[model samples]
Target: MTQQGVSWIDKLIWSWAPESFKEAGESIVKNFWLHWFPAKVSRRSLAFNYSFWLGTISAVLFAILGVTGVLLMFLYVPSVERAYPTMKDLDYVVAYGWLLRGVHRMAAHLMVAFVFFHMVRVFYTAAYKKSPTGGSRPLNWIVGVLLLVVTLALSYSGYLLPWDQLAYWAMVIGSNVAKSVPILGKKIQFLLIGGTEIGQATLIRFYVLHCVFLPLIALTLIVYHMWRIRKDGGLACMDQMVLKSEKERVESVGSKTYSLLGITRGMEVNVLTSARAEEENLIPSAPNLAKRILWVTLFTMFVTMVLAILVRMPLEAPANSAVAPNPAKAPWYFLWLQELIADTTIRLGRFTINGGFVGGVLIPGVLALWLALWPFLDKSSPQAAGVWFPRERLRQNVVFTLIVLGILVLLFIGGICRGPNWDFYWPWQPWPELPMHF
Candidate 1:
């Protein structure tokens, strides 16, 4: 494959074929990859440096999870009676099933981490702030945040699938937290569990949610998120130039304009070498995209495989509604909230707020709302948009960094430090024995 718009595959298949086939291949290649991603990207914005390609890494992980998850579905039947045994079969009976499940589980975890890293990268780079001429980036930022939420939901829903003590108690704690919401909490719980308690119905409900509904929604949102990245302009960094004037914008777009009536054939569309383009710095996406995606995919696969081999997915005793774990915990991602709820209460003089409502509902809701509205609220300089940790953006950066640190601290506490009765314990402390189910 070369920038002249011919691939080795095209030649292999179409060398003795019709010119129409060749032309078709060229057109598709031109319109698909090269059209959106021009020959030139900011040298700084290249995957070699600016991004570490976190977004691409996250996407690759999602794909890996999707493939492995589908394979797992064939073996797993979501029911109280069948779930745990099926998990054992996946590990011991099915060929390479443990590997598949392991990869899926690890990829899901990697995606969660990568998504957060991507958000941090976007923020420190000021990628979510407004562009010149006030074309805001907040819309895409909001979409990305929602994508993150979808990701968490996906992982949490899947957590219950093994139907073990870990899954069972986690669901109990998570659902009870949902039930603590001021109103509509019970309805939300019902929608999630399909009943008042964890049962065959709950497993089936979570099964569909994890395997079908959430994934579909996640894929749709992810596609939209990527589209918006292209629409808003690729990775914000030093390499991008803001189109300041309407004339510059039009000229920068070149002669290729889309119309409902259709683009006229035989019209000469100029290459994207408008007056604003820095031709010396531009490189074609043909080799770059291919190389980056391949490298990222391989790296992700290697890491996932290594993890899968070393740390098999855990399975505890099957769920029993009659017995509860000593200190039930939510999924690791939500441990921060769990810690907050366990540690504090809120009151406004005459008004008292339930700790669960404060930590699980109100605070998380406000934080999400704040994140969605941030682009509109901050009247920061557009010059700060592409730069990493610009001096002028110190205030916002510090604030976000503190928030992140606080969350990590909460996660550490909730995940490792708390033990029986949710009491504080050292990381090395032994857990109190609890009755096993099934």
Candidate 2:
């Protein structure tokens, strides 16, 4: 009787197990991972369930940056006057605070990298096709672009805090370059620097932008972007929907248009949507999404901690309005252009050009243009994207390649031809000499 009762208890436990741990009398029956299952989230996400873990990585990184930024905010003073010394103090006296700073920096870099990685993955999978549950690819592209911008802003703003040799010179270059804008250029540059040079005003403004504004915007966008992803998919596969018949296609159109907030031609036309609806469930659910989200978030925190402790980066001198640091260098990221414009020997025959246009102006300009154009350029029936090389590939490749080539050529010319002309020498060098048009 005792043995029979024990068997029944074992059977009961095995039946009750939540897809993880189970007891079969004397032996436990389950995979090694059964013990490590996660508590379910209210809303299941690829973050929680899936293995292709890009989005989860982004969320975890953002959390790290947010936590570290908040802590740093308490310690940071947004004053050119107090900023540099304050950073130095953090290094010397802030009780393991530098770890937070290091993690913040490293995470910012990683977030930028991950954004790029995410984009590549989306493209390769043709995941941008619109679906009922997951279709808003355009929104994803926009948010991704903004994420890159915020990453840049974070890097730019953070540099000013350190106030080091590299930092100071880089600011001078950035400010001067900004002044090269044709019309309101000087004014805009002045507004950013908060006066003529990198002073108390400039530092304070940067600190505010870096700590307050950019993060808020980036955070809001990421959340909104994710909500869009959920509304659109398992992962935006379109091929499953496209192969349906003409009758099915016509019916799907009016319904899809209304759902997308897209315009319709005639109210009289309504055919078939049910057949097309089956296309919604193409990509598999994010494998073990809950665990993925948890581990990714946890692991990023670990990485951030390691970066802070190991990196312990430095700060520069006190910002001085009076001193003009000669040979002012641009940030390493922007150095390619600074280096280009610095080349005075390559003159553009007659009109001495500024190379900053290529590094600072044209390349970034083209990148912006491409981001703006991607949705229209890539539009197609979701099902068609399954092909190895879609029929539309030729047109898109041609346009994309040409635009890319034009940008590179401009950068090359600007770098090679810019000389000691007033434009290159001191880009925003006070333009007092003016001709009131005759």
Candidate 3:
């Protein structure tokens, strides 16, 4: 191509693009959206192995859900009478409607999974711990916990939109679980379902929650969650690096002096009260971090689209309150709780314990509370932060891992092994047929 021919194209591109490194750094600070990110980030924080990019993938999945969900909102009807028919239309009538719905559903599930994995990664890395260099991260950890709850709530609220037998019974089981709470159980159930049972009111309430309330909450929490990362001085790994460097510097220089001069001047003064060299591990976030994020977003969306194409979303027969499926089950994510309820429910003579309350409410509540308050209780040294499975944190990691494995075991049993009337059956063994009813 001639220089004259390409000159106009180059001009067009450079109109927005920065021509120099200085300009690129300035653009990151000046742009509103990019400003949320730090001007520079540690190279350690950029490694895929360190954080697994799960948080980035989760955020991208949420964005996919939001976009596809809005498209679905146009075709879906909230009324119980029309909900199933509209779902059928989306599956067969509208152009690419099935794909849209599939993508949305798949993204929703992936977001939940990724968010959960992200939390686990944070726990194992001890990224939630506060350090002298990392600042306080416990508050951000609480925000993440709340975000997880909102994510699950978002999924649960949307589950009823199809109004199929699976959705209806799942909602029934969920509401009943709510009703198992001690004092406010009944009230909570009533408020959730909008009366004694699942009806038009229930559908509308869930629709509003799924479409409006929960998404808003999730979006807000996500924004704050990312912002908190910036405020906390990048990832916890950066703190580890800082601490290591400080230790090396201290050992190299025997006796040192500390002064307040660097504090007032906004310069980092070492133990010798002298200005140190700029951070060696830092790199500009404009192209480096932004490019990595772009790649992750594309990769996540591609995986979700592939899954959407290959898998068909389930659409059972229209909801029938009177004719429930034998051993009607909750959503797959809640299968663990369902299994727990079964295991905990016991009879001693005439008195029986309410397993729903014990397994669904009490146990889960205590677990969530413990997770939220754990940063305070953790007595591990700062050195443990950002180190995967550090020796000092091994016991807590083992306990957490065991709890996670237990939940997975229960989920498998509830979802795969339970047959009609909630009887135990091997996956290879055929379930006995029930008598036909007129």
TM-score of each: 0.83, 0.66, 0.90
Error of 3 at 7 (Å): 18
Write candidate 1's Cα lDDT for 44-98 as tens digits. Answer: 6674666778888888898998998998988998778888999999889999988
TM-score-based ranking, best first? 3, 1, 2
Q: Point out where model 1 deviates above 4 Å.
A: 1-8, 11-39, 133-136, 238-277, 345-353, 428-438
* Model 2 vs. true fold: TM: 0.66
Q: Please identify which of the two predictions, 2 or 3, would achieve the higher TM-score against the true structure.
A: 3
lDDT of each candidate versus the true structure: 0.77, 0.59, 0.86
- Candidates' RMSD to native: 7.6, 12.1, 5.0
For TM-score, the strongest prediction is 3
Residue-level lDDT tens digits of model 2 in 1-438: 244454544433333223432232122222222222222221223422222567667778878878888998888777655667778777788997677677877887777667656655555444555554346666676677777677777777877776766667678878877876667778989998999877778878887888888888888888777767555543443334433444465666645555423344532233323432443332122223334455777887887678767775655556554554443455544544665455532567797665555546665767776775576667666664423335655565456557545645544444443333324423334434443221
Regions of model 2 farther than 4 Å from truth: 1-52, 132-134, 238-287, 317-329, 336-346, 379-381, 384-438
